[model samples]
Target: MASEVVALVNPNTEAALPFATTLQLVVGQATEKGRKSQNEDAIGIRIPSGLALITKGVVSVISDGVSTAEGGAHASAISVSNFLADYYSTPESWGVQTSSSKVLTALNRWLYGLGQDYRDARRGFVCTFSALVFKSCSVHMLHVGDSRIYRFRHGELLQLTHDHSTNINSSNQYLTRALGMDVNLDVDYKTLSVEVDDVYLMTTDGVHDVLTEFEIHQKLTVLCQQHSTLSDDLCEQFCLMLNKKAFDLGSKDNLSSQLLSVSQLPKQAIDDVYQSLSSQPFPPPLSVGMKLDGYQVTHTLHQSQRSQVYRVVNDQGEAFCMKTPSVNYIDDAAYIERFMLESWIGQRINSTHVVKVVELQKIKSALYYVTEFLSGISLGEWLTQHKKAPVEEVLLLLKQIELGIRAFHRRETLHQDLKPDNIFITREGVVKIIDFGSCYIKGVAEISSPLTRDRILGTADYTAPEVILGYQADGRADLFSLAVIAFEMLAGQLPFKGKLEKCRTRQDYQRLDYISVHQLNPMVPEWMDNALKKALNIDPNLRQADTCELIHQLTTAKANQTVKDFVPLIARNPVRFWQVISIALFLCLVASLLNN
Candidate 1:
């Protein structure tokens, strides 16, 4: 048996998070042939360092080769190796499930192709695979076939994976699903909340089938009593002991086991999600040259009813933009949470076209966040300065903005409040997205909170029709907003003749109309205008799949509309799209009430 340990330490964990405690873990793994002539079981653990350690977290994988297959051993080894390598190579912005699933899908395809050399794939390369990913405060597990995953918490051992093999009898059994066994792989994915002192166990059937859960619990309990920690030596000894027991019990398969001990986990309560900043008192209204936490307010850039922005400079003379929630919302839980979410989300996103959220250097004495300041003018301001920009320049600006939006989308986020006023263009012509106050994060939204966390609407003019119609929105909603911006930039007017903002009901949406860019700007090509029209489709279903596709159409002349379909009231009487939906909903409500 062999053993290794990986210890993770995040230097900026607290700076990036509101909580002081970060994810800390101790990992140990072991494998042995036990009564078998060769060990077809493979177990490996990868605990990356640096930023990846924080974003991708630690991955532990195990695979059991089917002895009946000619290349079973090779398949198991390759699966384990490929998963670790490919998973880490995926974009850091992707969530754990997306990154792992895509890697596994590709890995399975490669292995399945190799198995085609045999008349029966079962007689070629085949293996049962299981992987445990420890990310932030959650554990994501992916499984195929009979390998098992378990968790030992608070002195109890609980099975976390199900066996995929069917039990016709003790002497006869067959795997229902496994990697490289079929073209279409159906893998099970499971996610669980993690806490301190949690020890997760992964094992092959050689040890688990021979030992009941209770027996495993007893053995785990003894290990806990004997050692204060799941150090490399202790974890290796535990695996070796399990292998010996299974061998003595007449087990005939290879043995492998892996252990993960969660030593520290961030605070779980939503209120504590950013407790440090959220608990800080809102700073008093600032005047020019006023200093707070060593940052001097050189100028108040902008102030709205909801928040305030100021250009600030510190001792090092570094220029930055600081944003503060209005004192009016100091007692508003929802608003405060939303305000906090902006800073939290900003700290994680990394894109040149996106304003960078600066990590807090000194202890903050007030409720505010800082971002790198760039000398730039808002897109709205720029639009007013130039009535109609060159077609090439407009496309260039749109392309940069798309990059920023794509960065957010890659992280499963949506800039719900996309608009001209919320975007900035540096003197160098670099477009940077700001104002994440209305942004939506898929992972963060799943967190439990007692406060009524609602979708705060963005600017009505740029907000998608679906959002106004009270429908669930995704990236398409943002695309709709981007399309509106693109249209406004080209024609120097709103698509529906500035009537979209007045829309309230189905009738108003139905009355909506589009003003072609060529009629106003004349310089916009027919293809570019068509692309913008498609993107501004009132129905999200009809809009471009993503911002990149929309940008592609504008830059590529051949990307022309190839099909025709009836758009609802919005396309014809554009203002009527919003009204049609509201009126229909109102009539439905009346009918239901009368029927009741």
Candidate 2:
């Protein structure tokens, strides 16, 4: 049996968030062989020190090897090692759920494959797994098999995970769901808000099955009271004592336990974030054939006041597009912050519909990032090529864009800037959404930024009215932008002719009339126009809730169009019907005048 303790402190004196920096934790772990010939249980904790601790947070994993399986100890060790390793390497833009789940899924598949190669179904690489991740102010948990995670706070004990075991008989139980047992693995994930003084525990089945929740709580309470004040030594001793007690209770399997106490929570400080954002200076502008780091500039792909994109080739003859901050706003801290965030967001969002940001092999010169060169035409150009596209074709493209937007939404990010130019269609008919410079992340928004942006970040024609009205936009705003794009694709024009930027008030927006798509393109059905109207509603509350709803309305709109068949003639053909009525009235007046 052995016990270890690790402690951390707030390293950065300069902070970026508005709140004071206070996130701290104390951790302790212990493992015991018990009566087993060898200990097959593995436990590990990674409490990153600086920015990593703030961005990625802390990770702790505990895995229990199947006693009857061969190489179970090795399997448990690998599961913990691979999970912590891959999780940090994942893009920081990804939420904790995404990063943790992806790493676990890949780890599960590897273990299952190894088990299949062993050719022994029962004695294969199998184990139960559970993990706890403390990031920012939230604790995210991922679980599989029978390992348990528990929270003990203020005399109350809460079990955070469910066991995946089935009782086969009174004396024997089997894991219903575990890594290496199936080709496909399902992981349970959840998140909880963290507060100071909270205590969390992770235990392998060997320890948890023997020790009741009340017993564990009592042990934790005693240790906390003895310390009077929290310390790493106290936590370490408590973990060892808890594991030893479990073994004393006649636990025959390898035992492992981990304890974590929240000492502080992270807060965004304006200066700290500014310093991190402005750590690197902007690179100078480059000309064709100019060499930067190892990249040779081949062409100028794009140029804007905010950024410059260049097609570059590396020493290995691989092509990439390097985007650098525009020198025009080099001194603008807020602009630089958003520019850096654009790179981070690009790296985080993984979708074929979105552009891929490549990781450079070596540190590059200045502050810039590279991306895979996409050989495709912008949606704007595609629109010019295929004006008045069929509804089906437009729907297909819109669906792809929606998928990309949903990916952003999953990460709690909103792509505030969505327009025809931001979308691309590859030669193979693959549609992608690009340009995340104007994205808004919930986490980032919570931080106190150095600059306050009063201006809208979206294009005038495609921007939702709510944004123009100085309100915070959400996923529905992105849906509105997509709706406008869809309307342009089908009708070859915007739903409203006036500029949104010019509408400073609600009444100004209300005065702008929505033009029927059917009037622009007679091929457009009334039902389709109705769908667009709902999506393009000046009031965001009236717009479709999400892209999926909009898609459903657009696809099933034909049924609604059928209802238009029964409309009164005056309603359907008001122009022709009113013209006949006017002529008849004129003849009657003429006859009356003649008789008089």
Per-prediction TM-score, please? 0.70, 0.63
Q: Give all candidates' CA lDDT scores.
A: 0.82, 0.79
lDDT of 1 by residue, 1-596 (tens): 11111212123322223322256688777788988899999999998765566567789999999999988899999999989999988755467888887888888888899999888756878999999988767889999999999999889778888899998897878899999888788999988998888998899998888888889999989889888867766777777888788888888889888888887764455444435335568888898989998999999999989899999999999999999889998767678767766877787789999999887755677678899998979999999987778888888899999999998998888889999999999999899998899887765553334456777889899998888888878899989888889888888887888888889886677567777888898888888888888888777788788899999888987637444445556556544777888899999999999999
Go through the candidates in order and give the clash count of each.
28, 11
Candidate 2 structure quality by residue, lDDT tens digits, 261-291? 9986665455555555565667899899998
Model 1: residues with Cα > 4 Å off, grouped in runs? 1-31, 44-60, 66-93, 102-126, 132-139, 145-187, 190-251, 256-275, 315-318, 332-341, 359-363, 446-454, 468-472, 502-523, 559-596
lDDT of 1: 0.82
Residue-pair clashes, model 2: 11
Error of 1 at 587 (Å): 29
